[model samples]
Target: MGEIWMIGATGRAGRNISAELQADRHRIVLVGRNGQRLAEAAAAIAALGGPPPRTLVTDDPLAQIATGRPDVVVNTVGPFGATTVPTAHACVAAGSHYVDLANEFQPVQSLLGLDPAARTAGSTLVTGAGFGTLATEALVSELCAGRPSPIRVRVAAMPVVDGLGPAVLASVVDAAATGGLVYRDGRLTRSRLGAHLQHTPLPDGTMRATVAVPTGELEAALNASGAGDVIATSSEVPTGRIARVALPIVGAVLRVEAVRRTVIRLIDRWQLTPPATPGEVSWAYASTEWEGGETRQAWLQAGEGYAFTSRVAAMVATRLADGDARPGAFTPGALFGADLARSAGATITLDSNAKDLR
Candidate 1:
């Protein structure tokens, strides 16, 4: 088995992905900032009745990637706007394949923009290997596969997570700071945060209020569908009338660097988070409209968000370690198709009006 280095090995996503890889008898090296925590995680992995994982404690992840030069690096670190670029650059420089569960718009775009360099180095870089972008992106691809280029594409991600971590919160805050972003005329454009509020009907006959948010799904959907207009919304965003009214004000404050930092600091110190009772099912929907009157829609149903994320990340990492991936940057959906999510316990349902592209 190829050697794989897992950054943030002790974190939630890292722990789950490591367990998945280890269960398959893959050789893994747990890398984290805390030596004790990394050791503890390794112990837990060993206790799971597989090969014990090696440990590396380091604050400088780039340095570790450069020197240690593992065959593959799975970066589970977050607020990826700050970590993704440098880490990816290091992986390219070191000629190591890289994969990350990053769903932020900036980092996803940044990593995908590294195609030339990654190709030159013969290293594959996959981003948005998590529930954030993959689910919606997969749906977009499924809906647009047999059809011509769509004029408009709308995608929504509504994951039911069992819990939230500080990193996830930070990522949300960072996206909020970015305000509303949508692809228009094949270009990224700005709008108010929580703008384009609408009621999204889930597969279970339940309607959830969703709002426009800056997410990697926006970019992924555009690339996958080649749509001229695309909007990415999420059920995780606040959608009440009050929230809609206050979003502009909040978005303005977050745009200020100092204010954004203070808010993030407060969130961390206060441990402010939403409740933890996640539902058993997560839903992602995509609707595509061509120039005439034709339209298509699809629903991607998956298991628990975190569990599906772990499986998706594991599957992608396994493919990378086994040299099944091509040298370039990609979203899981763009690289592996919607079936990747199904293999990770997801189901795709198409509207009666839409053709079953699968």
Candidate 2:
């Protein structure tokens, strides 16, 4: 097996992915800024039934990826808006495949924009290799298959997370600062943050009040379905009646650049904990309405968020390492199809019986 280097190897998601990749018998090189934490993570991986992964402590990740020349580099670092481009470029330069667990809008779009370069360099770059984007994207792909371009596509991500770290909080704040966006008439347009609230029904016989968020799925859905209108939402936002009333007001404040930065810093410094533990199952839902009045919906159910994310990241990296992926920048679904999501433990269900194509 070729050596795979994982950045942010000590992070929660990074450690889990490391163990999974190790279980597949892949040689892992743990890369992180802290030596002690990396050692501990390596030990944990070793305990999981693999030889201790080689560890590299480095502040300059790009330089290390270039010099070490691993077959694949998995980036688990957050605030990927800042990390994705540089790291992906380094991978291209080193002729190494790159994958990141990024679901943020800017990073996902930014990474995809590098497709020409990645193809030229003969390296595959994949973003949103996590539950946040993959599940929804896969559903969109499934629904739109063999159908005319959809006029509208709506997607929602409802994940059950056991915990949230300060970094996750910071990422949310950063997304809020990006405000809301959706694809309309085949072009991206801005919308108010937390706008367009809806009670999204899950396949598990329940509904969650979701609000529009500028998630990477918005772009992925548009690409997958060729939809002229797209709205990406999430159940992560506050959904109560009172909370819904106040969200727009809060979003207004967050839209201010300085205020957003201050909020992120405060959240980071205080290390705020999320209020509740999410449920055991996570879901991704999407509905598409086509030009001929045909409508279709699909659902993806998976285990808890972080564990699912680990599975997805490992699966994508494994595929790339084994030469299953072609040279291009892609999301997991766009590259490997919805089956990859299923292989990583997501149950997919499509609803087309009620829709008439004729």
Candidate 3:
């Protein structure tokens, strides 16, 4: 069994991924800031008839990781803009594989930029191992397969999450502060936040409103389709008319370093009410246009977002631990192909005819 260490072991995604790894009989070490919470998470795992997990309470997880050097590290901590690069660097230095559920634009691009270092260290680092990036990225990959480079690509993520967390809120603030970004002529371009508002159609024959947001899915789509122009949209953000008018102003205000930090600090202390359970299905949509106006569209249908994220993170970490991945840095689907989504309990549908891309 591979030795796997889970950072933020007490959080929702961490706990779920821990259970998944336990079911596969891998050895897990729970790492967190609170000793009691870590112990409780370990106890919950043992209560499921699995072996007791080792728990490590440390304020400095990077030092612990560098010292212990587990075979694989799964980082569930968010504001991944701050956590992903440092943790992945530590893992590379320690010669361990790394995986994280980061869907922010900067962090995802920065992590993927570590490909040379990871290859030199013989370590695999996978980022965006979650619904937002993988769900749409996988579809783009499928639609672009066996085709020449597309001229334009658009991807939309519409996940149904059951709850919110402080870290999630903080990440949103960080993303908003970064403003909106799109790929134009193979270059990253800045745009107004909440631009390109779209009334996207779902597989269920209903329409959901989405707005362009700078997200990792944008970078992932560009890489997957080799498109000269790419834009990523999401339904997670407020997309109403009022929000559209206000988003650019809000983004501009948040761009102030002090204001952004202050907002994030307050968000960290928020005790938000748990949201109602998500609907039965979530969908990620992507449409690609080739040089001569040949266009292809696809969608990936899955269950609740959090459960799918847990599964994807767990599967990616497990595969990395098993030496099934190449020594480099990549987004999940970029490393494992579209099949990674299928393995994580998502189904892909291609074209207007609803042909299955399984």
Q: Which candidate should be chosen as best, given lDDT against the real structure? A: 3
List, residue by residue over 19-133, the lDDT tens digit for candidate 2.
9998999989999889999999999899988688999999998998888888999998767876889999999999999999888798899999999999999999999999989
Pick the winner on lDDT between candidates 2 and 3: 3
TM-score of each: 0.96, 0.94, 0.96
lDDT of 2: 0.86
Prediction 1 global C-alpha lDDT:
0.87
Query: 89-136, model 1: which lDDT tens digit per residue?
Result: 999999999989888788898899999999989999999998978999
For every candidate in turn, the CA RMSD to the true structure comes to 2.5, 2.4, 2.6
Residue lDDT tens for model 3, 1-358: 5799999999888999999998888889999999999999999988877789999999999999899999999998878988999999999999999999989899999999999999999999999999999999999999988989989999999988888677777788889999999999999999999999887777777787889998999999999999999999998888888989999999999999999888878777774333444677888999888776677789899999989999999999888888798899999999999999999999998884432221
Q: Which candidate is the best by TM-score?
A: 3
lDDT of 2 at 297: 83
Error of 3 at 2 (Å): 1.3
Scored by CA lDDT, what does every candidate get?
A: 0.87, 0.86, 0.90
Q: Candidate 1, residue 187: CA error in Å?
A: 2.0
